[model samples]
Target: MVVAIGLEGSANKLGVGIVKDGEVLSNCRRTYITPPGEGFLPKETAQHHRKHILPLIKEALEVAKMEPQDIDLICYTKGPGMGAPLVSVAVVARTIAQLWNKPIVGVNHCIGHIEMGRAITKCDNPTVLYVSGGNTQVIAYACNRYRIFGETIDIAVGNCLDRFARLVNLSNDPSPGYNIEQAALKGKKLLPLPYSVKGMDVSFSGILSHIEEKGRPLLKSGEYTVEDLCFSLQETVFAMLVETTERAMAHTGSQEVLLVGGVACNVRLQEMMAQMVKERGGIVYATDERYCIDNGAMIAQAGALLYASTGQPTPWDETYIRQRYRTDEVEVTWR
Candidate 1:
């Protein structure tokens, strides 16, 4: 059985996990929390990762009842994240690898999420809707790659929500997106927001601008409530996402839909996708925060798969990080 330790700190979350043969033995994370109306800075986030990574590593190993020498491989998210945070995690991963004399591999963060989603849900070849603070894409397996069927032309869906939350001074604890989702639950009115979807791609910057310029002023003037804004934002953005996902499914003939990412934990989004899939006589698969949100287990899972297939680790000098590693750029050899 392959035993791997995964490190992930692509954004504000610093996670460490131990996995054996696709099973997660330990998954622990520490999120960097900022004040309301303030977003996480890349440098600050990197510092947070540096401060907590060692403790998290020790906690993970302890929880798994393993030692550094027991680990056969070390895997870390190589990119498509903030450069500083990615580098911070990479430094720790490299040090661990050298200290333990274990093999090391760099895994794509997006592919890690997709792989972990499939593993946890047992859904094979599902059309995936990946939504997070940094990305938004509709993906499906084709030609040995996680091909992007649709994507955001501007800001990602989660980023849109996060910026809106800041506009409304939402708490950063837990997550601003989660707080928005909760506020949306109490919504009684659906305010109008721009619905911008150009063919296979969607644009959220316009919507975010509109909300901030129009919605917030109205909210300040007592013409609308935060719940109304939250409700309208979720409704409009989620509808666009579902529309694109449906089109992709129809095009790809995929009967299963998989939701993966930090934002994938949204119940309303899941419910919307489920309703659409149900109409098509298909099913939707999702996981809790442990698997849906950023975590180390996913990196470990994807890295372990690649390592098991190749039986090789990247040369130590070739482990440079990629800040813009696209999902389609990764060759799906394990699949």
Candidate 2:
């Protein structure tokens, strides 16, 4: 039985997963909430990783009924994330690899999300809509690579959500997205908001700002409910995603759509995407919380497949963080 242990300390999350032959046995994650005064601090994220990574790994192994020595391969997220967090995970993975005398593979965080979506939804040849705090892209598998059909020209969708949440003072508990979703549920009015889409690319900064400026006054004056603002925001953003995804599907001739990343967990977004795909007689696949959001299981899934096919490992010295790593930069070694 071949076993793999995956580690992920990419952004503010520390994750560990144990898998065997593509089956995820245990996946553990810890989220680090950035304090109000201190913005996304890399050093703090790394500190959180240092504190939680080992325990999470151990817990995953225990849940999987395996030991560190039982792992045939070790995998860690490599780049497209915060530098310090990546380094923290890489260090732990390297240490484990050296201790167990196992080969370690560095996995791309975006591809990890894609592969995990595939694993959970069992979708083949689907156009992927990946939206997170750091990324918002429409990807499709074609000609041995995942092609980026569309992406944000500036900020990401989740970033917009977080920013809007902060504007409304909704970041005290849960997640911004979650809080927004809850607020949207009680929404009663559809406030006009900017909807910007340039060719295949989309921009949310303007819309976010518009919401803050136009809706804030109404929210303050008790003219519009917070729910209404949240509803409108979700509608505008989800519409942009649906529009871009539909365009990508048509261009790529893909009939299946897979929604991945943290934002994929949004029930409203999922519903909207599913409705859009169904209207076109296409299928939409989405993972549950386990794989929808960032986690180590997906890293292990992608890394194990890459390792099996290539027998190559990213050199420790060569590993580095890429705040903007294109999906096409790395060839898909495993289909």
Candidate 3:
């Protein structure tokens, strides 16, 4: 069996995981939590990853009960994230590959999420809704690529929620999105917010701006609680997501809808997507936070698939990270 260890630090969370074939042996992650209303900066997030990466890697190895020499390849997320954080983990991957004398693969971060979702859920050739802090897209495999059928034209869905949390000074403990979900549970009213959907793409920046303006006076006057704003935002934004996903499903004639990425963990979004798919005699495949959010195991899984097909590692100079790497840029060799 081909064994690989993956390192992921493209965002705030630092993760390490081991995968053999399609099975995940271990997935470990440590998130960098900032104070209330504060967001993680790229430089600081990179520093956090650098500090905790070694321990996390050791922990993953122990959990997998495998030594470095047992691993055949190493993988790291090479793109679509903060430059500093991507480089932080890339440096570590290079070190490990050279020390262990194993081949290395640089996997696309978005493709990593999709591949991991498919592997864990066993949903083959499903339409993927990848919603996260940095990305929001409806993807489907076609013509040797994961083509984007729909996406956000402005800010991503997760970024909209996180920024709203900051406006309300919400705790960033578990996650801004998680906090919003909880607050939404207690919300009884749905305040009006802008909903912009052009063709297959969504726009969230306008809604965020509208909510900030409406929420400022209401919050100060005690006319509306943060809970109401959270509820309204979730309802409006998730509806747009569901609508766009439904359109993609209709266009692609897909019977399965798979949710991947950090924001995919939201129960409300899942419920909305499920309801929409159910009406069309389809099913929605979603995983828990472990597989949904950014992690190393997914990277390893995607890298392993590509490695199996190509039987080659990325050249030392070509392993550098790409900040704006698009999902279509990655050729789906395994599929």
Candidate 4:
């Protein structure tokens, strides 16, 4: 039955998930939210994870209708995430491994998303667009590895949106990005923001600065509304992402596109990508908020795959947290 539990606390969210034989039995999560104009700090985020991880773990186990004895393996994100939050979750994973006497494996955060997306959507040989607060890349599977075809040269697409939301003092109740998405729905006129796409790689910093300079003064003068600012910015950035992803698809000769990551939940981004993919006669696959956003089940799924293929758990000494883990660094032997 090969049951596994995954611990994920890469950024503001902390999640626990239980999976058995590639099926996610339970996924529980808690998020740390800052004020409208602020972003969650590493220290604050780590504290939030620490306070809720134990309870969240219990919830996941109960929800999955399983006990610790049934769990064959434990998984934790060995990351490309904030140092404090990554360490906080990794410590818990290690502790539980010892307490439960179960095998443990450190999973790459990005690969976790890819594996879950593939498992849920059942897409084959798809060009992946991984967009999140901390990362933005167009990737393709090749030679037993998920290769990065293109990536952000500066701030990520999510970072660009969050920063712009912060600049406009958008509500952060659910998330700054969600708030911006909502506000953008009422956007009337498209603003002229820089569309920076240098071949496969995209840049968002210049557009962010340009929006601050051009949008802020007009907003203060009542010349532009928040909706207008959000709408224009979203349009510009998503277009850049779609363009680069298309380039990767053409280069890889792929007929399928899979969107995975926090930003993958955005409907507008999905629509834009779908339009482009349709023109190319390709399929576009995406999951809703449940699987797209950061969570534990994805890690568990990926970890279980690794354990199944290699039959070796990560040694305690080698299970250290990696703050700058790259997507391309992982070897996908399970494929």
Candidate 5:
């Protein structure tokens, strides 16, 4: 079996995971959380990863009961993430590869999530809805690539939630998005919010502006609670996502919908998707934070697949970070 160590620090989370072939032996990570009403910056995020990556790597190896020598391969997220944080993790993976004399491969962060989701849920050839702090896309496998069906025109869905959380002074400890999801649960009223979906693409900037500009009055005048605003936001945005995904499903004639990414952990979104899928007599698959959110195990899983297929390592010179790596760029040879 191929033993691999995966490194991921694409954004605020620094994760290290060890996997033997397709089995995950250890998954360890540290999230860089900012104070309430604050968002993490690239410099600080990279610093956080640098501070914790070594310890997490040690912890992961210890938990896996393995040594660097036992690791047959080292894998890391090559990107579609913050430049500083991506470079920081890449530096560590490169150093370890040289020190351990192990083969190394650079994996795309999005494919990492997709591959891990497929593995954990055992859902084959399902349409993917990827929602995260940095990205929002509806995708499907076609022509040896993860083809994007639709995507955000401006800010991502998670960014919309995170910024909204900041506006309302929500805690970013666990995550601003999680806090928003919690606040939305007690909502009793459906306040008005903009619904901007142009064909398959979505736009959240206008909705965010409307809430920030108009919804504040309702909150201040005691007409609407934070819960109400959050609930409305979630309902409106999730409806758009579901609509676009359904369109893609109809076009592709696929019966399964797989939700992957950090926001995939949201119960409301999953419930909404499940409801829609059930109506169409299809299934919806999702995973909790371990696999849903950014983690190194995914990188390891995807990397191991690539390595197993090619029997080769990514060259040291070509292991550069592509901060804006698109999901459709990587050719899916493993499939």
Candidate 6:
């Protein structure tokens, strides 16, 4: 068995996965909440990665019943994430690759999510909707690349949720999305909010501002509950996503939709997407927490495919973190 170890510390989460022959043996992650409450601080996140990544990697390796020396390859996320966090993971991965004398491959974070969704769902040629704190995009495979059919013009969908949660002093533990989802379940009112969609791209900045403005006045007057605001926010944002994704599928002539990213784990979002797709005689594939959120398994899955097909192992000298890498910039070598 050709074993591969993967590391992902691109955001606040530290993940490690072990895979052999395209099958995941173990995948583990340790999530870190921001200290200042909302939004990630690059320097702080890097420190967290430095402190927690080693233990998580060790735990994953032990769970897989393998050592660093037993691995044939080491894979790490290289771009489309915060620079400090990405650099932290890259430094560790390079050190391991050098120490173990193993080949290293740097994988795109977004592609890792898509590839992992494919692996988990066995969905071939599905139109991908990638929604996260840093990104919101509609992707489809065509020609030799995964094309971005549409994306957010301003802030990401998950970012909107986190920001809104922080605005109302929601729980700072775990993730704001979870807190928002929980609050939404208890909510009774549906507050009207803005919905912006242009051609294929979507925008949430206006909606976020509107929610804050409306909710603040109501809270000050004691006329509305926070739960209602949370519920309204999820409903509006998720509805926009459903509409745009459906439009993208129609344009691309795709019968399958794959939801991948940290926000994809939201049950409400999944239900909305699944219902919409089912109505159109299409299928929706949603991953659980393992692949939905950032994890090392997806990195290994994507890297192994790239390595096997391209026969190009990443050089330690060329390994660097890219904060603003675009999904369209990468050419997909694996189908």
> What's the count of clashing pairs in each model shown?
0, 0, 0, 0, 0, 0
Badly placed stretches (over 4 Å) of model 6 are: 35-37
Model 2 worst lDDT run, 10 consecutive residues: 32-41
User: What tens-digit string does per-residue lDDT give for candidate 2 at 1-335?
Assistant: 55778898888878999878879999999988854323467998899899998789889988999877788888888878888988888888888888888888888889999988888788889999999988999999877788899999989999898888877777635467888999999998999888899999999999988997898689889989878999999999999999999999999888999999888999999999989999999999988778877899988998888888787877767655565567777789777
Residue 20 miss distance in model 6 (angstroms): 1.7
Model 3 RMSD, rounded to 1 decimal: 0.7
Write the residue-wise lDDT of candidate 4 on 1-335 in tens digits: 67999999999989999989989999999999998899999999999999999999999999999899989999999998999999999999999999999999999999999999999999988999999999999999999999999999999899999999899898888888888898999999898988899988999999999999898789889988999999999999999999999999999999999999999999999999999999999999999988998999999999999999999999889999999999999999898
- The CA lDDT at 13 in model 3 is 84
Candidate 4 regions with alpha-carbon error over 4 angstroms: none
Candidate 1 lDDT over residue span 109-137, tens digit each: 99999999998999988999999999999
lDDT of all the models against the reference?
0.94, 0.86, 0.94, 0.94, 0.94, 0.90
Candidate 2 ranges beyond 4 A from true positions: 35-39
Off by over 4 Å in 3: none
On TM-score, the stronger of 2 and 3 is 3
**Per-candidate TM vs. native?**
0.99, 0.96, 0.99, 0.99, 0.99, 0.97
Of the two candidates 4 and 6, the one with more favorable TM-score, higher being better, is 4
- Candidate 2 — what's its lDDT? 0.86
Clashing pairs in 4: none
Displacement of residue 172 (Cα, Å) in model 1 is: 0.7
Clashing pairs in 2: none
lDDT of 6 by residue, 1-335 (tens): 45778899888888999888779999999887863356778899889899988898889989999877789989999988988999999999998988888999999999999988998899989999999989999999988798998999999998999899889988757789988999999999888888798888899999998988888999888777999999999999899899989998998999999999999999999999999999999999998887899999999988898888888898667787788888888888766
